[model samples]
Target: MSINFEALDLRAFLAVAEAGSFRAAADALALSQPALSRRIQRLEGLVGGPLLERTTRRVALTALGRELMPLVRRLLDEADSGLFGLRGAAGRGARVTLACVPTAAFYFLPAVIARFTEQLPEVRFRILDLSATEGLDAVSRGEADFGINFLGASDAAVSFDPLLEDPFVLACRRDHPLAAQARVDWADLQPYRLVTVGRESGNRILLETALARENVRMRWFYEVTHLSTSLGLVEAGLGVSVLPRLATPQGEHPIIVTRPITPRVTRTIGIVARRGRPLAPAAQRFRELLIETWADKVLADKVSVDRPRP
Candidate 1:
């Protein structure tokens, strides 16, 4: 006798096996308890074996069900993968979910997206703006296809590809005493109140490490989360800040000015993904676009200087 097991039946079987009761599985699957029971019965009949042992108060999977669990999971995963592959082959386009640090979303992603969309208009993008740490977690959990964050050694389950080296710069009001100087030293900044991104940020860690080496004790007047807010506070003369040069807004923001910090500090921005996983075609294309755009547009115009230089 030929037997056919539908996707819905397999899903119902898995739900029932996991939940241990038709009522619980029904709630989980959003189906009626009777409907779920029927699906499991149909599944067991198709397999020519009893899949579960049921009593008044409980349910438990039989030996055959226990043995089939792994195969069922693999079948589900493979089915989804096969469907995705077919979609790509048919040119239906693929969706990529990208998680990124807020600064990258504010500064780097716009240009890269403009170039990417120009080439692959059919593809869609879902962007998650997260903190550096959170973005890294999202990629590792497979919640996102890939992520862009500060370059640092991540969990062994994750891998990174360096994209750009962005330097930290001092930002102050235009009429501030240090604004007119070519560059300002760490000592000169000590006298002023400092506004900066919060300590949780990777940028903050880099700044703190540099200051620690020099034994500098700078006063922080404000520790804000957003780059734009930090710049706003500086423009209002509340304090000066060290921010990534890339994150500096292009247009004039009242009296705000950005100047290179004399003893240069820099951070590497990179792409991160699951260590052993293959990227979907759309995600791979987007990654390539980001690298190409950074090289052709952003990096080409920069003055080459050794990093962490004084």
Candidate 2:
């Protein structure tokens, strides 16, 4: 169904959501309380549901409103950024939002953000550090301007620009038996306790499928929801973990070391953005900077391998 609503209506909803009171929202929007109510009513009608639940004291977002907040924020932000032919863009917030897998966010974004901030100190960032599936969702739905993700190269809705080929490696404490080896084979891990992420994780699925093809099966002695958790377990000497090399700390960690595993399993880390979508000027600049930052012969050569990522 085609639905049309004015920007003022969205502003009315946002003001109420933020203030949690229609009176305060109306005051902030410079509209009479009744006027604000009508705009909200009109918006609710168009949406076919109430966006808020109003009590005498405060207002709360409905389930649908909770889900709509990110998309709405993005729409208003884009409009403010001169994406919708609206003027008065001087009022734009100058904020850039990107969804990223926690691993990539931890590994890459700090340096990239630091560099971007050096150039554009006035700009701000909102990072949605989600999983691969969630990151892809955010980029595809425009809730994020783009994403740093390991999935979505074949997805038609977004463009995935490869940054590196991150192979799965064995993560263990420096004192662990496997750490003595220059490199470990998948069979080498069979004798040790294995720490892994939960099966629901995208990385787990990818790794499991790839290892199965190599006739290597992993049995998890401990399963956690995050790769970082697995790494923590490994560092504590509970068991070793199999994870992307990028998920490990760069350089040396006093307790932890990663060993290359053969035959290799890899994931392609990259930038993901909605196809044909033009990012706001600041976002476009940051995206370019991120690509340029990773465009290094040394870094690429270090991660590049013959293994095909799932």
Candidate 3:
């Protein structure tokens, strides 16, 4: 049979059942005797059985009430335990840890981290800056809460949530022949020496994978393992490097500029967390903030590029 008693009713019944004196129970519950009686009466109505035998001097539990007492106590105990766990899990002093590729760690996450820390001053972060492959491994192995990386090969151990599409751009010195153009094609960049990341880099893999789909390949005169090195080479008039628009600095650079590649190629960046596993409250909050920050960045970049030039 289904019972409709509230927790308050259960508590009130338990209080009176234990004390065996309505007056004493009332005092313990900080309730008037009549109010306590009313609560027991409501509980009886829902339980469809009288739970207490009350008299002028003594109170006792009926057989049904005695049978239910242990069950009620266990329920209360479990409820308290659950609430205690929830409170501790979301506490302000908790540490949030996650992983992401170096490119994201460098260009995207710092601003998001600054804003998140402002909201949760006591929260600590253990941000693992690794390659996309390593980031995925960290989350899968439970070493990290989650990761951010370009969308590529599926994994049964991890899940991805696409946040934004980062397009490849041509990074070149301001004085380069094609730097003045708003956009340049892959073929246009072929005439000049090209700098690219090493094959070990996830960025390089993503670029090569994209180019292979179109049956296109470019000769790389200079190959570097770091984006900073690629930028340095571009600044020194070595050659232009193709990179995600997000990798380039937001504002004007005195010597180097990034122009979008024509027939725009892009990579999908997203969140990767362990399959069927939920993140801690702090990690979840940081994930939401990252999404909001990315959305703001996308809008701001669109406005900056679309606004009328003076």
Candidate 4:
């Protein structure tokens, strides 16, 4: 004869074994007394012996039941732990973790994140506001599911997907001479003392590389650690600054204005992920949202720039 048992049988037996009375066990398990009895009977049948000794007012375990008690308790304990572990893993997956450059985090990513979260109210986000190189490292080191940053030299462990080209633009005080022009060339900036980000910044490296290739040079009178800080300097009539178009203030800042530069140079931003690794469902969904929204924004920017201004 073969012996078989189900989780329900073990659970019922454990509940009855621990509660000390059928009525108490039935109440605890949220089952009728008769149903609880039936479950114990099924387990007893498989065991081929009486497991519980029932009296008019109390219940006691047989010798066989005592032997099986510890084993059944261990099995149930392990099962519960495994189920809880799986639940924890699922909870972690419900949130998307993305590493993004400060430029994207400031101007491009927030709107897309708002739209993505609206459709997934249960989903959450952990945004790592890192620099281009740091963002790349986050994804490559498995600290983030994906990253949005410039197309820099990446390791063999990661792959890149081009997203958008953010061109460098000139930012100046509203009443400055360059603000009235439709566009100013790099050569046109020669006369101005420029406020630029420090050499430590990836933006500075990009500017240096592009300028070296174009064979252009400019005098940098003030250096700041952050692009936003450069804007303040420009606003105070210190000097003009060249920064990514995305870094420019979006709304009308009466003290500041931005203009495109001739012989435009752009930094290509992209998505970075560990090679051959798949994104969690939430991360993949957010990635799709980023791509779609980016397309709309690029088109809109082009249309706005092409429109004739009064």
Best by TM-score: 3
* Backbone clashes, each candidate: 0, 0, 0, 0
The residue-by-residue lDDT of candidate 2 on 95-210, one tens digit each, is 89999998888877889889988877777899999999999999999999999998887787888778888889999998998899999999999999999998889899889989
- lDDT score of model 4? 0.83
Q: Candidate 1, overall lDDT? A: 0.80
- lDDT (Cα, tens digit) per residue for candidate 4, span 1-310: 5667888889899888888988888898898999999999999999889899998687899999999999999998999999877755554449888888888887667788789767766778888988777787888888999988774434556766666678899999888999899999999999999999888788898888998898988789999988889999999999999999888898788889999998888877767777778888678878888878876655223321111223
Per-residue CA lDDT of model 3 for 76-166, tens digit only, reads 7888788877866695688877788777777778889899888877789888988777788788899998888874336656777666678
TM-score of 3: 0.69
Q: List the lowest-lDDT window of 10 residues for candidate 4.
A: 300-309
Q: Quantify all predictions' global Cα lDDT against the true fold.
A: 0.80, 0.86, 0.81, 0.83
Better of 1 and 3 by lDDT: 3
In model 3, what is the error at residue 151, expressed in angstroms?
4.2
Candidate 3, residue 261: the lDDT equals 86
TM-scores of all models? 0.65, 0.66, 0.69, 0.65
Model 3 stretches astray by more than 4 angstroms: 1-85, 151-153, 292-310
Worst 10 residues of 1 by lDDT: 300-309
